[model samples]
Target: MMFWLAFMLLLSAAQRGDAQWDWLTGIFGGGTTGSSTGQNDPNCGVAAGSRIIGGQYASQGMFPWQVSLQNLAQGGSHGCGGSLFNNEWVITAGHCVDGMTNPAMWRVRMGLASLQYYENGEQEFTVTKVIMHPSYTASAMGFPRNDVALMKLNRPATVSNYVNNICLPDRDASVGTNCVVSGWGVYDIQSQYFGQAPLSATLKWTYAPILDPGYCSQNYIWGSEMVSSIMVCAGYDHGQDDACNGDSGGPFICPSPDGSRWELNGIVSWGEQPCGAQYKPSAYTRVTAFKSWIQQTIQSN
Candidate 1:
């Protein structure tokens, strides 16, 4: 009788322990398990909270996929922002890597919230390969089309609470959906010398609602020629929130349709000067448009 009682007690303890674990996982997204090198991991896109830009500072680990694409040749200056696709790959805009394809000239800084100061859990990786989309093109005035690119790191990233992969969208987000845009870019658009304005030392984010393609094409200076089928338009008619210079190649992430996690929906591509201009929402490279290309390139290479 005593043996059976002890067995029941042990079983009850184990069940209670599992319940506690489940509660913790629900609160923190997931525990540190699963492979960090592949996108198949269930932990992808998990974060501590959801928020971004008219913009504000992001808490550490709030956007673990955010990364700074730094130019080593330019004294390690930040050239663009990117999203972590997987442990070994990063996604950015083709224009950001255009005419600057030398892998030796770049470094990727991850798990960091500031460009000017070192933070805990920061990781830096040397790039081994730069791959731009084959159909990528630039307009006469320097605007880009099919503006997506990928960078392969020398090795896979060491995933942690502060570093993780973002989910690739299974389908395109709907028009009017509010998405988050984060980067260490110029926050003040009203400066007289806007062209010479300094980039934000700390990361900033803002909310940009996806706009209708028809409306975007009509408002742009180049009209339909500029807002093609592969691009996405976001921001507002009043221009209160938008990505600007130094934010190129950053992520335009949105909540999954079910609101379980975040998904990378777009790549910051182009916007008008003195950004956040009325009726001129910023343009992004629609990530879903290149989904197959991204997967096949990563697989074959």
Candidate 2:
């Protein structure tokens, strides 16, 4: 009788655990995600592709604020991308630095279009500190909430045509207009075996329109629960143009109404499985939602 009681207790615990897993799966969709990048390749080379699904190769110095976050743990391979917000700070996805917070083990490469090859104006900076959102909870099974982070550079980035800082959005900023996302992430999601080699070694970009929150939540297999108030969605329902692996923590840049400059509007957070899938749009951390928080953090730090 005692043995039977223990078995019942064990079964109950298992069921409860499964119930929680099921809930997350129902909200964020379920499927094993593949590697974020290929085995580390330090050699710089140009990528092969027409573009990011439908994007084009970016001209040198086009998006000067674009930067690459290199993982020294991964042999200096590009793990994720970021944007230079100012001389001393960069904004990226919190998930990008979740377990790899060692500042000495990371570096920021800016003013370069190619990952493997440094251009005439390329500059690399050592990271002094990493600050993730206090409420950030990185989950493999749930939406990446509060997915923003700031990296303090050891020295200020020299402002130039090829190394300018991107502007941030204000609290009242709204992005009804289409935004551009640039990165060196993989152009094809199915080429995981190729690893970092299959990725775009050169900078590439695609246009993803800002999606309505209500419509974004309803379309994914995980349903609307995957999208929180802090997140936003962009990409085609029937995938054509989208950002993929290695692109996380990059910017969703939009032009100012006056057309003189662009503002950082979004941070690449997470997306549906099999990136760029039909009817599956990618999600981003809405920058406006955290505008005040960003200000406070920068000031306090």
Candidate 3:
């Protein structure tokens, strides 16, 4: 009888474990196969199409790695955009968390396509730690240098059809390579009132092409030497589609050589005052330059 009781207890515990697993999987849309957790995962960067700044609305699961960094103190307002580095970490602009370094005050929302609506696959997590690069510099006259940052989630995100990680670039994308930048940023800069630009309710993306650093440096109001080696410039000569306010910290992703996966090449750093201004392309923090730093930081912390 005692032997039979032990068997029943084991069965009950197993059933409870299965039930808990099912509940979590149901929330994140995870399947029996489990969540994709690394860059090597075949499902990383898998999206419905190739695409984001004069950007169009993205469909569901179009950019699975996109993340909305929300400020809890401000009523969960979406402050900056980010990309999923992995199940436990998120990559974003350093300036986004500069003054707001308290991890408890921040939340990350993923698997989301709309800011106003919460979808079935959407996952939210409280940040446990915020790591900004030691060399990160915020400048009033020029774009921030070493603008990259990482936020550790309170819990690992479950990978699903709607959530995945983006692959980091091995090398810099060549000038003139077309890339996409996506966010829920402001749609109309001119329509803003009282110095406040309204953010988009839906995720939007636009195509931006990598531009020559020399040309970008020459065009900026700061003149030559404004565009640093660690930064990349991307936009058009006429400035039709460009990243604007509220789009900071988002990924500038380009297709790999074979076109099999998307690789993050840049992080939206800074831009001209009036967005989409002619001859004034936006500046992005070159991801390739800080690959080692990123790896070390993630590994040690």
Candidate 4:
């Protein structure tokens, strides 16, 4: 009953353009909107100059690793965000493909910024395979465990300024480190009414500071939910920016100490209610914790 209610609510909220309609809220008690059984628009109601909950429009060719996961089986529309890990592989949240595991039903859009426009550099590819973590499990309250997955592209992407890969983190993310998160999620969560604002069409980027696991688990919204060591929490003390319903599977990137390159530290998994509330940072699948799993999956398969 809860699943059905959440599914329906997500559909209605998305169609109504409800700004407060966040998937990782209490609808499923703690679920993310990236589920295959439900729907969230990739570029549904973007306002002219707004951004991802308090972010700024990402410059063209700035985030080459960004990718859009579109569900062609349901309809050729965007569903979730993804990271171009390599020429033939893309990384995303496990829940993004949980219900719809068929690779034939999915496609990836690369080298694009505006979701409304297919620019000259945009490229599309059919997904050939999906490799979800073996321990993945969706809790009754909607929290997903081991919420990470990898997709294989039908063909290798030709790397370019607008399309490339991001480096994976070599170690666990450090607390207090500032990272960049980019996506095309809801523009704002504080809108007074639904349908008043539009979703983000252009990719957006924001700054988030990594939080201490102890602080996140003891003082945040999901305190009773138990923070997993494999997950990393990050947000602002003021909580103006965050990853929302459609932002799942996107990359949480941190810059190198020397500022030479960006490393893939986390994958947007879920967050607290109302999207970006104060003292409620979002949770991400710690990429560093699954480094071996990722490499092993890639090498064996």
Which candidate ranks first by lDDT, i.e. highest? 1
RMSD of each: 14.8, 15.8, 15.4, 11.4
**lDDT values for all models:** 0.74, 0.65, 0.72, 0.68
Worst 10 residues of 4 by lDDT: 3-12
Tens digit of per-residue lDDT, candidate 2, span 225-254: 677778777776666467767788987876
By lDDT, the candidates rank as: 1, 3, 4, 2
lDDT of 1 at 94: 91
Clash list (residue pairs), candidate 2: 38-195, 38-196, 44-116, 217-224, 237-279
Task: Give a tens-digit lDDT track for model 4, residues 177-272.
Answer: 877677877657664136443457788877777988878878434574558888988986566577776778888888655444567899988765
Off by over 4 Å in 2: 1-55, 140-142, 171-176, 192-197, 219-222
The model with the greater TM-score, 1 or 4, is: 1
Candidate with best TM-score: 1
Model 3: per-residue Cα lDDT over 255-299, one tens digit each: 776676778899888876656566777788899898888777776
How displaced is residue 42 in candidate 2, in Å? Answer: 36
Q: In candidate 2, what residue range of length 10 has the lowest lDDT sum?
A: 1-10
Ranking by TM-score: 1, 3, 4, 2
Clashes of 3: 5
How high a TM-score does candidate 4 get?
Answer: 0.79
